[model samples]
Target: MDQTTAIIDLDLPGPRISRHVYGHFAEHLGRCIYGGFFVGEDSDVPNERGIRTDVVEALRALSIPNLRWPGGCFADDYHWRDGIGPRDQRPRMVNSHWGDVVEDNSFGTHEFMDLCELLGTDAYISGNVGSGSVAEMSEWIEYLTRADDSPMADLRRRNGRDEPWKVPFFGIGNEAWGCGGNLRVEQFASLARQYSTYVRNHAGNEVYRIAAGASDADLHWTEVLMQSFDALDRAEEADAPAGPFQAVSLHYYTMTGPWADKGSATEFSEDEWYLALERAGYMDQLLTRHGQVMDRYDPHRRVGLVVDEWGTWWNVEPGTNPGFLYQQNTLRDALVASVHLDAFHRHAERVVMANIAQTVNVLQAMLLTDPESGALVRTPSYHVFEMNTGHHDADSLDVHLQGVPTRTGEKSELPLVSASASTRGGTALVSLTNLDAQAGRTVVLDLRGRDVVGHSARVLSAPGLATHNTPEAPDAVAPVTLDAVRPHDRGLEVTLPAHSYVTVSLTLA
Candidate 1:
């Protein structure tokens, strides 16, 4: 059997992988907001201000950095004022984007901020630029952050919140070219600049304004957004004042099939598995290519690349709402998550933040909540995030693959081994994913420039690729201690089983 090797240079650490890179996205779509995260203050399920307690507890385990809210397509059409004031007095609207269900405006700004507080995560608020006015977007920011005797601030106090809430990240718009407004890249660039100008910082609460960017291979959208920035446009803590925007957003989803026919989430063939992984690996290419374009404009890497929407998008489950985008999470989804995270680490210098699409009961979600049964099940993807919490705020280490094996796909080939490493304080965490489905492989960690005194490892795998968790069998695919680790003179050796994700924590000297 061929052996895979990953060479890690302990002394040559890369950029600080921002904890924000591990961010999550929650949109007011499908069960994500109503049944998933917010079970209502009156729900039988335990909740804190309508925020699901179990869901918050599950996400808190990952120490989720930031959460993008009220978005995807909903951000463009949503009016913040309708969601504020009294819950009963709040207006009702139709969520045309997802399931076409009537939105009671129950889960609005206050509820979302409360949810963020409960989870100890930052808020990434996406404003409505498509259907709303510049004044509306401006007032929303002011209402959330203004603390002094201002009109918006006074209104906020009357509404309930006496003190202002810090909005760390604010999005000017969502996908301006598509569901956002169907505007051209050039048109959206102008609108983004206009809309972001009003998203101001109030009372020292600095907001990181992120403009809507591209998806997949739309490099032109990135170029236009980058070119729109001038010397005055910069993030907080820069030499100049916070300008038009601090970052440009990107949206990507891994699907083996096409848009009209996204492949099944649970039932899939071997070819589909390899194809799905290969698609997830494409995030690296998107980052590198977009970074090249961004570098031409801002060589200092001032503007960050925020992938706010990402994850596996499969067809909806049988008999479910087609527009709801509800799907099951499996071991394959876990591998896909690991692959994209590894890519984010590889481009840590440019990719500052990322949020997997839909936090609960949506695409590639962390928890699946069945309110009917009152059961909250953690998906396999959740375990991967929980195990990788150590990588947050750590310095990314350079990982070089040598003698890596490959699996032949129908049209392309994929590397059987994928890995990334990081160091925080004195401990280094190495993440490895073996994509092989039927065979296990031996991998050697060639640690250089550091003395490893002690090491521990954990592995996540299941008997089959389609293995998933339900309320009845929540532990079907979960992380377990890998006893096959051995200490070598160089570093540590791990025996990775088929279709598994492993993390080895090394105490460095």
Candidate 2:
């Protein structure tokens, strides 16, 4: 095959993509909270209000834009009243679904807002509509946001926090089609309307009300929500006075093979690994299909697409509780994240916000926590997030590349190379990932319309495919800075190693 040169024209301007979509989720599952973010004030790890300072600092370093709190399935059963006032006074409940463990409600409303403040990210509070009532949801919103001296605000002051927390994002319910309530689209639509009515926008802050959407590729769910929004809009025009649903959500997890035999974390055949990659690469199609559904009713594109939950779901670590949902991160996982982000950039017009499943000690977490030792470790996914932070809120640029696909088993032709470029703060940043495991590819990045002067590159690769970060060897998978990167007259040429992810930032002249 001849070396094909594809020209990428960045002359046309594109919409400024919102960085909020690059958000994260943190649930009450396993060590994600008790041992992950919270190590208790008495623990050896330095902590404030039982939250590890080390974990906070690590997440802050990543420049996390937003975080979702409490439950995947747990959100439905969570009640705001259980986790308030004095810590000792708080009630403890059984986590029936996740390990059947007991939840002390220690990390409640105030704790979450405090964590968001510490990390400097917006808080996306998913309201409890499955088990709770509209009055309960409304009161929770009022308690956190209302500045007036109402009953909820007074209760908040009694709890220790006097000032109202600035919560800009809200989700009516999580996975309403599944764990949330098992409600169909039509059923959830009425429920969404009732729940959203009580969520008052306090302090004049614009709260982005995101309705519960499809689990994955459920076109009927999307259509129903869109139609509901349309009907509500028309009714409002006819003097009904309704607030618009700011965004619709979609959740997807990349899992290959049977759910029972999901392979191993650190050990996998090349074919199985490639199958995983092929699954992760499906984000493009997922977004495309969902976006098509939204375009039908929302042609003007008023509503934003929020992919609130997404990541790779592999088998849990050996001997660990299955409900912990813990797994190892490899270079393959990093490539999956890269391709997903690239796809998000391609559809930035509609796909506005997304959050990786859970931040730590869960599926494809960015950080890992050790409750016994109070130690915090970074995962391969963490490095990918750090490297790609430059693309957040930057204008997505057009890029074209022609390369053969990476194939495995019956499934062939996965995009061997995936990339996205954006200009921010007078610097053009290009992130490229070579997903092929066996071969390295030299990518020639053409900057015809955009000026390129000096450049530097950072790469994250492993010695082998099975390489990962263990508790003892936390720094096993980290990024290395390439010192020598010369900018040619035409563009930049960089050699990408096999199964590697590289990020290059060029100072535009």
Candidate 3:
């Protein structure tokens, strides 16, 4: 591949990238909650109320903005009462969604909220809407956010906490058209309006309620949901105001093949590797199409599109529970993260927040959990997040790339050089990713209105897509400080390697 050119105008600005765009998702699937994050105090792992202390510190290091919890499909079956109160008294139940494994109900609402406080991240709770009554869902909200003298509030007090925990974002259900209830699109929309009505927004917590949108290219489902939003918004004119719907959420997962055989996480051919990248690049298209639908109803773009569930979904690691969805992360996963995140940065106006599926010890997790010895190792995906921290809350700058090649027809066309820029104060970050797995390209980064007096660069690249991190070899695929970065007269010239992601910071004079 020939060297490319990327031009950036530092003064050009776009919407502020929400910190929540870098949010994470932690579900009850497999060991994601049980052993992955919550290791009882008796174990060798450091813990506070069964939450692993090391994991907490790791998350804090990333300054993770928000965390969604309890379920993918498990949320629909989650009984809030069963998980509250004393751990010993909390009833056990079968997971029913992930595996037929027993759920000891040890980690509940209080523990989850406490974990959120420990990591200093906001909580995004998913309520049960499938096979559960409306009052059941409403009462759970009261237990978490209501400080009033209601019965639910009293129950929360008796359970232990005097003050209510804040819930900034809430999802009414997981996948209402599938595991959530298997209802039709219109039926889910009708049910979403009814269920969302009872979700209370108490003091100190406005509750950014997110309605579940369609899967991948299911534009009809989003249209139906928006139609419901229109009706709800119009009710205010009639003096019968309805609840607020701040955002609509869509879920997409990158799959190299069919669900039954989603190729190996650690071992795959170059074709499959490119296929994974191709699947990932489709996130941009999905957001663009979904954003267009949202604009039809929300022309002013008031409502946000939250990609609450995303990341590569692959076959479980061999010998693990098939339903657990546990997989390893490689340099390939890191590239996928950069690709999706760059998309979010470009569409900062419509795409507000996105939570990568399973923050730890599940599919595309940041940390791989060794259940036997209670050891944790950071995955390549974690390094991607750490490198991208500069994008949080920064104003986007206009970036243009030319002479870029493309990989056509796997799922979508992927450019060889993907880039995004953001500015904060006197500091500006220029990030670029080279999608070519076998060829390197030198990028002529053209800059205007900014002088790169000093700079630093961090890059994540590996020998091949099969390279990954394990407990024995944690640093096998970590970021290295690149010394090739230097400031030039025609802008900052940089060269990106095959299948690499680099972020350069320009400290203005």
Candidate 4:
């Protein structure tokens, strides 16, 4: 076993790791919407007003803070009106982006809000800018949030909901550099400023407007957005229509292979494992670099950085529609999630929110639903989320590592371990991941500034990298109570298995 030591100074707590950092994304692609999260009320699957009941029950365990809706690329094409009135009379449109299948507009604005309520999560609406107008985007907000007797509110009443819903986060556009219109940074920044002007706050519901930002390593996009923001005269615009955008978004996905031939999700060699970890670890550099540019414009870190889209994107499973982006989740994917989330926790001050690429039946998904049998399977990534729930809304405690092992990949190097720590009222949660595929790790917790009285841990591991859960054996990669944790003179000592993730709950004295 490899040995390492990490120290956490409870007196030196950093920023509050926003629960929003643990958010999820659900787009109108593949089984994600139609068969994964929603099956019609008439279907055999148990549902609440067409929203999947079993799926909600499972996700609720994670205390899901927020959910991003409408699109990734689909948001720019979605027209909220088409989904409102009557479902049977709704227009049918080609998804175009995902599988070229017809979107019956069955799961529209109302259904989405219903899903959020069922999951007890905040709503994050990504508006259309590629193919939509400012008036359309403005009125959609009014229709969902204006509680008074207005044209849009009255239309909403006629559509059945008398009271408006709450929309907390709003995205101006999604990926304008690509599917969201293929626009230049200057053009999108100007559009973001203009369109965001009309996304009004209604009935005291304040929407955190997030402008579409760069993909991987595009620091120029961040520069342009901050430059545009620097031009705004906030002092004079104190109570402006829709206050200046509160945040800018970034999208980064970890892929083991190149885009044209992204490798398999479950089938991979040992070398591929270290490559994925190295790629995932690159998010730290992306956050730090972009944050430096933003700091030059806004030194106080007032504006937030939202990683609205991120996860591992792999090739579609065999016989699956390529456009749908359906892939299997395994131990490797779970570790990828841990790496990204640990990065998010470390940069909590600047990264205000993050949404994994998807929540169900899509890339790096949490749950997979069987279209034919209506069976629900929880992915290993789901267990990671559930296990890390203790970190939500908790103050981040920096972990100082010493003598950590490293593995060199084909193009990059990766530390064999990744970790983050946080504390709530009287308890502290230490999350650790061992990236080595064939070596166990003995980690010593050098607790400082706080006395640890008791500790218990659970480990999420599998016999191999490809271990995953199917409906036949749902607990294939589930967490088990770790029996190797013991109390040391300074704090706790944990024995982590190879290619495993562990969370230790400590009772602070």
Candidate 5:
């Protein structure tokens, strides 16, 4: 293949983007809680408030912006009252949907809020509306955000926390059309209104309430919600909130081949890996389709798109409990994350917040915990987030690439190279990943339109597509500094190794 180079226009029209989209989810399923975040206060692992201190410190290091807690399905079954006050008094219930494990309610509201405080990220709380009432949802908001000498505030003070933590983001429910309730769009929309009506934000608190949104690329659901919002606007007049909904939620997972025929996490053919990349590339279409529907009603883009659930969901690692949802993060997952991040960056105008399916022990976790020793190993996905943090809150620049297809398959073909550039603090950072496994690509970046000086690159690659970091070999996929490249009068050319992810930070003159 001939070395292909493209001149990309550096000037873009979009406004500066927000970094909240780079959030994470922490569900109560499997080891995600018991062994992942909470390892028992009495255990050998050092802990505070029953949360693993080491885990808290590590997540803080990543600068996680927000954490969606209590569940996907687990949120629907959760009862807030059971988790507060005394540990011994907390009620135990069966997690009917997730492996039928018994939930002790030990790590409830207090634990979640404390974890968020430790990580320095905002909390995106998903309320329980499937089996709960509107009053219950209202009380949850009151319990978390209400201040002064109220019943809930007194309860919070009695429980050890003296002040109300600022809860900025709140979801009406989780996958309301699925595990959340199996309700139709009309039913869910009404339910959303009923639940959101009572979620009062105390004085000086501005809460972002998001409605349960479409599953995948279901345009009908989006239509129903949009129509409902319009109807509500006329009925309620000026009494309603700023907008019926602050954001609409969407969820999608990338799986190679068929869902049932998903390729293994640690073992996969080159064809299978390429297929996974193709599936990941679908994010661009998903967001664009949803954006088209949203633009019809929210033409001014008043509402944001929150992809609260997203990431790769492959088969579990061998020998581990299938219920644990454990999987290895290979170069494939890293590339998938990069592609998704690039897509999110491209749609930064509409996409405001996103949380990877989970933070630990679940699908596409960033950190994996060792139940035996309380050790946490960073995954390839974690490093991907760490390296791309510079793009957070940065102005995304327009980037165009002229390249061959990375892989051609029956259903899809991905570009040989994917890239996203952003300018922040007078520095131009470009994140690029080569999905091809056979050869490297020399990309000539056009910087003539923008001012940039010298350049430095950090690259992460493995011996092969199947190479992964195991518990025993944790640093196998770490990033290494590549040779320095001098910025030319017109542009800069950097060689991207095959099946590798590279991030270049240029000092703008």
Candidate 6:
């Protein structure tokens, strides 16, 4: 059988790999917090201070660098005061955006921070700028990060914790043009400025302030935001101008068509698979076009692009509330993950951080949890993260790939393989995805810059596109060590099975 040839030239290196690129998001919606990740301290699910012990072990395996919490749209509506203090004193509110279920303020600021501490990850706090006042937003920051004797800090101490926690990443709002506040570009920017100004920095914790960015292909939002920041810069010239933000965020997802009919997660046709992969590949175009618009204003690239919410969204599980985006993770979802990751690695200079939507029991989640059974299963997407761990903080290697034939259909065309590579220390990591639904690809992975001494590889796939794991069969779809990893003249070669994702860690001399 003749195999399609694809060349990977590792000679070209790009930006430094950001560890934050592999970040995850855990929103205050669905079972993500209540029953999925945090089951309360009293639960018998084997918890460490209310955080699921099993999820802790799983996330730690991937070296999860950062976690964004509290909201997608929930952040805009979240009032910090209502979530802090004694649990009995806290007020309950409806999670208006995700399921109108009354959200008991049980798992609040302290619990989330505790989870972050347990997992050893940086916390990305999405603050409220929409319905929240400047004082409310400012006080929330003061309570979390200030070690001084201020009222907010004092209140935090009285609640429980005496020491302040570090707030590394903070977003001023979320989806401002829509669920966040439905504000115009100018209005959102104005409020972002005012809210951010009141957010004080203390205890030597330099927060990476993020501006609530566009929802999908809204490139105009990015342009207006930078313009708004530029105007802010000019106004602050006399007062030692502080940079506007560390990054501006963007949100996108892969679903079967529009919101009205986001087809089933498990049930899909071949054409739907093509549509899904096509949607995933468009992340590249989104980054490229959005980056170009960002460059027009930020010529020096002082601020990077943060894809805060992204994943394959689908119709919620049967018998579940439609608003709770709980969908099963399948082999198809793993391919979607690999496709977006390749796009992120290629545009590392501009795309600094990306977080997959709702980390558990939600859209394209990494884990499916059952609080009743105390059953936890790591999803196929979870294996992809562990496989690509080599790319965290690794120097980006611009691996040029070609010669793989395209899978042409009436609606979409995807190359048989999509790949990227990075190196840290003396080892290089190459990730390749065989997006083809039927045929396997034999790729001659070329490591151009150095000679390899040895290597190891692993592949994550299943018998079918929809193959997935349930609590009863947790290991149904997991990674396997590939014996086909072989040394070529100056590089390596590997064969990828149909609908598979492979990662190679090469030892370079």
Q: Number of clashing residue pairs in every model?
A: 0, 2, 0, 1, 0, 0
Q: How do the residues 1-509 of candidate 3 rate in per-residue lDDT, one tens digit apiece?
A: 37677888877777898989999999989889988889777877878877898899888888999999887799998888899988889999999889888998898999999999999999999888886888998898888998888898899899899999889989988888899999898898888888888887776668888887789999999998888775433423434332456678999999888978988888888888888888888888999999998887766676779999999998998998998888999999989999999999999988889999989989889898788776789999999899988888999987888889987756467787888989998889888998888998888888887676778898899888679998888888999987776566777778777889999988875
The residue pairs in collision within model 6 are none
Q: How many angstroms is residue 157 displaced in model 1 relative to the true structure, after the best TM-score fit?
A: 0.8
Error of 6 at 324 (Å): 1.8
What is the C-alpha lDDT profile of model 5 across 251-369, one tens digit per residue?
Answer: 99998857775669888888888888888889899999999987877666777889999999988888877776788788889999999999999999889999998898888988888
On a 0 to 1 TM-score scale, where does candidate 4 land against the true structure?
0.97
Candidate 4 Cα errors over 4 Å, as ranges: 230-243
Candidate 1's displacement at residue 457, Å, is 0.2
Error at 140, model 1, angstroms:
0.3
Worst 10 residues of 3 by lDDT: 233-242
lDDT of each: 0.91, 0.82, 0.86, 0.92, 0.83, 0.84
Candidate with more favorable, higher lDDT: 3 or 6: 3
Model 1 earns a TM-score of 0.98
Winning candidate number (lDDT): 4
Off by over 4 Å in 2: 1-6, 231-242, 404-412, 483-489
lDDT of 1 by residue, 181-239 (tens): 99899999899889888898899998888999998889999999888988633445445
Alpha-carbon shift of residue 338 in model 6 (angstroms): 0.6
Q: What's the CA error at residue 328 for candidate 5, in Å?
A: 1.4
Residue 242's lDDT in candidate 4: 25
TM-score of each: 0.98, 0.95, 0.96, 0.97, 0.95, 0.96
